[model samples]
Target: MQSKATTPTEYIHELPDDRKEVITKLRDTILSNLPEGFEETMNYGMLGYVVPHSKYPDGYHCDPKLPLPFINIASQKNHIGFYHMGIYSDPNLLEWFTTEYPKYVSGKLDMGKSCIRFKNMKKIPFELLGELASKMTAEQWIERYESVVKK
Candidate 1:
């Protein structure tokens, strides 16, 4: 569940031992494959990777004071959330995910536009997540987000 933690490290620290492991592994996998330019921080009571205001001074269009959110990882009440902006904004990536995910996960790929709900961490496709993260750069995400806004 979302916590009161203000920092990513604190967020990780707040997790119970089991949750810590799951988030840690996910965090590590994302970090290893995350394209250059995104910065990791805490956002919305979860761990987030964002395009800092320094890169896009206007910041998130919805909230100019905040950085542009790229991806988020949160421990929720019933499950874990792996939020991917890339998939939400890019159809090809979403298609790739839909096509490839069944191979790694045994359960239904419970998901929304961007949030992938994981009932069991073991079902998470680690390598696929890594590849997804690696596919988008901060600039690419910014361009995609801006293009959507323009439309």
Candidate 2:
């Protein structure tokens, strides 16, 4: 990914006209409710709210390099996606999101270990997204993610 010392403003400035409006709204909702120490960055060509490893170096028992987690906003060929790390690692969180995201669950949503992909911005619940973002620290979320994957 092209890294340019991403700032929230810089990331927003890079978006296309159509995407700028949507991404800006997403950025606003996330920053307004973000927890302390969370940072705005650009990773993998997307806007990432990173909780850097230095912030929680001792939190992970296994992979120390797997820094803290935060939500991400990405622009793709077809649409924009919002990713939530908790969904992949936390069973409780996944179960909750699975139930919460039924409308998009069937064959539309694409996910990796902890990402929720959306083609349309409105498909996600902004309030619920904020709630998820607020619930776990980067360390806590990573530990849970590592633990779940180990099983």
Best by lDDT: 1
Task: Give residue 58's error in model 2 in angstroms.
Answer: 6.7
Error of 2 at 73 (Å): 1.5
Name the regions of candidate 1 deviating beyond 4 angstroms.
149-151
**Model 1 per-residue lDDT at 17:** 88
**Candidate 1 at residue 146, lDDT?**
90
TM for every model, in the order presented, reads 0.96, 0.72
Candidate 1 per-residue lDDT, tens place, 41-78, comes to: 98878899999988989888777898999999999988
RMSD of each: 1.2, 3.8
lDDT of 2 by residue, 1-151 (tens): 3436357678668767887887787788888877777777765567887767667664334455644545777766676677776666577887776676654334554666666666765565666666667777755755665676444
lDDT of each: 0.89, 0.67
